[model samples]
Target: MRAHHLAAAVLVAALWGFNFVAIDVGLDSLPPLLFVALRFVLAALPVAVLAPVYGPPAPWRYIAAIGLSMGFLQFGVLFVGMDVGVPGGLASLVLQTQAFFTAIFGFLVFGERPRPRQIAGMAVAFTGIALLGLDLESIAATALGLTLVVAAAAGWAVSNLLMKAARPRNTLHLMCWISLIAPVPLLALSAAVDGPAAMATALRGVTLETLGILVYVALFTTLVGFGIWAYLLRVYTAATVAPFSLLVPVFGMSFSALLLDEPFTALKLAAAVLVIVGLALNIGLVPGRIVPQRSART
Candidate 1:
């Protein structure tokens, strides 16, 4: 990748990193699923305006599946897990499990095999999760929150598979379409689980702070952050672009510690290192850098 492209990737990483903090803040105002629902509502706006002019209708069935898995399930569980007092830093770290889940699901569904290094990396990552699990009771959220985050990662992996299956030409467009599909179902689920009374009370109590969080998450993180990511993936090899995404948790943990006053303990640091290393390996990258010929655009 060129210098400018690398810069864009870094920017995206930073925005996505801060996204955890935004979501954490938003949870103070909205219920988990309601917050997720609002985020998607804003996310779907561009599609509502642009789809008519830019293209035919989006792939509805596929986008709906993507929404169910990635938008509703992933974000819903993640919000809940974080709301239960999982520190944004650790939540960011644990969510890297999505890469492993993607690889496993890819193999099971499509017979795509991982290279030996990828397999080793996954084992190492699992070991890291095990290490964190040993200290599960030490964290404020406990094991349930951690488990929910892992389940959220699995939901992301499922979305990855759906995206792969759909083979959409423009991932950003797919994302916009999914945002449209996700919000209503998520809101419905939220009301069902949270109850009509609590939902009404929460909605009435929404403040500018909550709205600010929604705007940050939906516009900056989901839209612009992913807009840059899609651009990078299109212009560069996945190997080159993927590592930049790994920087997200580094920034996430740092910002969480600095801004939220969250503790960064030694054992947690070790676990973060393991997961980041595994993430690097899973992306098929080494420190020396391997730049492949850019493949034709999908």
Candidate 2:
């Protein structure tokens, strides 16, 4: 990787690391599913309109699948998990499980197997997560929250595999599709659980802070951040682009403390170390030969 790509990778990690803060802020004024719906709707609209100019359009089905898997399932589960009290820092750590799930799914769905080193890395990471889970202070206090986030992580893994399988020619088109497809299920679910009234309240009382936050998520995080990252991946090897992503949780923890006032407990610190080590092992696997096609963009 060139120094420039490496720097861009770091920037990507930083933006995503603090994503938990954005998520928490957005959730303050929006129902989890509704928030997700709004997010995708906002993200999809511009990209869809500009697809012809910037890139080729993907088949409608591919776009729909991206939205369903990445937009709806992934964010829906994540928001609910956070709503249920998953700490942003811990949630950041746990969500990396999508990598493990991606490996598992690739093997099952596409007949790809992890190399020995990859498997070993996964085991070590899993052990660390187990230790985190056993921590009497954090995981024990928020079992339900942890469960929801883990489910979210698993959903992300499934989505990653599906995206890799589809392999849309235009990566931006793929993201656009996720944006387009995500709103349907999210809207339906939001209406069902929170009722129309809750959504109405969310919209009617939408403040500047709410709108600003939404725009930030829709533009910078989903559009610009993901767009740049995707372009870089195409320009470089996955190994070159992927390794830096391990920094997201580190940023997540720091931002959680700075913004959300979430504690950096001893247990969480240990879990963070374990998670990073696991991510290193996972990404450091023989890159070119055992390319992991399945990876979550966010």
Candidate 3:
């Protein structure tokens, strides 16, 4: 990768890394599912209006699958989990488990085999995750938060595979359209679960901070970060681009501790290291490169 693109990759990681805290802040004012619904709405509206869909319209079923799984369900659960207690730092680490799940899904669905190293990495990472599950710190680290985030991670893996299977000619465009599609169902879900009163309170309570977070997430993290990432993928091999993503958890942990005052426990540290190592081994596999087709999740 060119130095410029490498720098852009790092920037994307940072934007996404700190985004967990943004979710936490926004959820203070917004209900979880409602927050997610608004997020996708804000993310998609301008793009939907300004940009044409990435390719010919995708299959409705495929579009719905991506919209619901990736945009609504994954984020819906994630915001709820984080708001309940999942520390932003640890949440970032746990979500990276998507790397393992993605490989698993690819194997099961596409018959694509994970390299032996990746298998080993998955085992190591899961072992660390098990340690995390034994967490005595708080509910955030416990099943309440952990399970939901893990579910989100698994959803993300499925979303990526759907993209692969659909094989859209222009994935970036499909992503924009999926963003548009994902939010509506979530709005309906939020109205049912969060209740009309909760939604009313959230809207009434919206402050500058909440709006800032919403805009930051919609524009910076989802749009700008991904725009640069997609550009890098088009220009470079995945191997050249993917490992820099390991830095996301680093920034996430730092921002969580510094910004949110979350703990940096021994077990969490160990888990982070193990997960990073596992992801490194899995991502930077044989042949020293992955073709651009296997894009990293933003």
Candidate 4:
């Protein structure tokens, strides 16, 4: 990766890390569903308005799947999970399980085998989760939160697979479609689950702090951050892009401590380390000797 791309990766990581804090703050003023709806709505506008400049318009099918799967289900359930009392730090950690699930999904659905190092990584990851599971307070709070977040993660993984399977030429075009189509479901769901009163309630006493959080999440995290990511992925191999994502959890933990006043528990620290190690292993950090097969005698 070039220095600028490296900087972009770190920038994306930091912005995404701070997203947990933003989500926590935003939930204070708005229902999760409503907040999520508003978020994608903001995200969609620029791409929709500048469609000609960005790329060709997306088909409805592509738009809807990316929208519902990636935009709505992913962020919607995540917001709900976090709002329901998932600790920001733990929520950040748990969400990384998406990579594990994605690997599993790839193997099961697409018949790709996990590399040997990946198998070892899974073992390390299991140990990390075991450490987390032993924590009483974190476990209790995280049970429901983790469930919902995991659901979102699965949705995200599915979306990723679909994006690859579809192989759209333009990343921005796909994202535009996702952004455009996502808000409708989010709005409908938010209205159904949270009701009109939730919107009214959130709007009535919203402070500058809350609005700042919303703007930050909408612009920085969803729009600018993802835009850069898609650009990098377009420019490089997915493997190159994927490895930097491990930095996300590192940033997440540090930002959580700064923003949410979350503690750096030994368990959390250990879990973070294991998660990073597992990601590295999964992506083949260890060198393997290349063995050549001998030619068969006739």
Ranking by lDDT: 1, 3, 2, 4
lDDT of 4: 0.76
Q: Which is better, 3 or 4, measured by TM-score?
A: 3
Candidates' C-alpha lDDT? 0.85, 0.79, 0.81, 0.76
Candidate 4: minimum summed lDDT over ten consecutive residues — where? 289-298
Residue-by-residue lDDT tens digits, candidate 1, 1-298: 6678778999998998899988878888889998899899999989867788765234678877888888766898899889876888788888889999999999999999998989989998888877887876564457888888988988889988999888887888788888887888888999899998998999899898888889999999988999899887888778767877788899899999899887888888888889988888888777766765565774
- Candidate 3 — which pairs collide? 54-173, 85-140
Which candidate do you rate higher for TM-score, 2 or 3?
Answer: 3
Judged by TM-score, which candidate is best?
A: 1
Tens-digit lDDT track of model 3 for 262-296? 88888888888899888878886444365444334
lDDT of 2 by residue, 48-102 (tens): 5776676535667766776788776688999888887777767788899889888
Backbone clashes per model, in order? Answer: 0, 0, 2, 0
Clashes of 1: 0
In model 4, pairs of residues that clash are none
TM-score of each: 0.95, 0.90, 0.91, 0.88
Candidate 3, residue 58: lDDT: 69
Question: Which stretches of model 1 miss by more than 4 angstroms?
Answer: 55-58, 289-298
Which candidate leads the pack in lDDT?
Answer: 1
lDDT per residue as tens, model 4, 1-298: 6788889988998898888888877888888888887787777777756776756455567667777887666888888988886776677777877777778889988998988888888778757766776773744456677678767777778887777676776766566567777778877887898887877878787889888887898889877888899887767766667777887878887887887788888777888788778877887654354222222221
lDDT, residue 276, model 2: 78
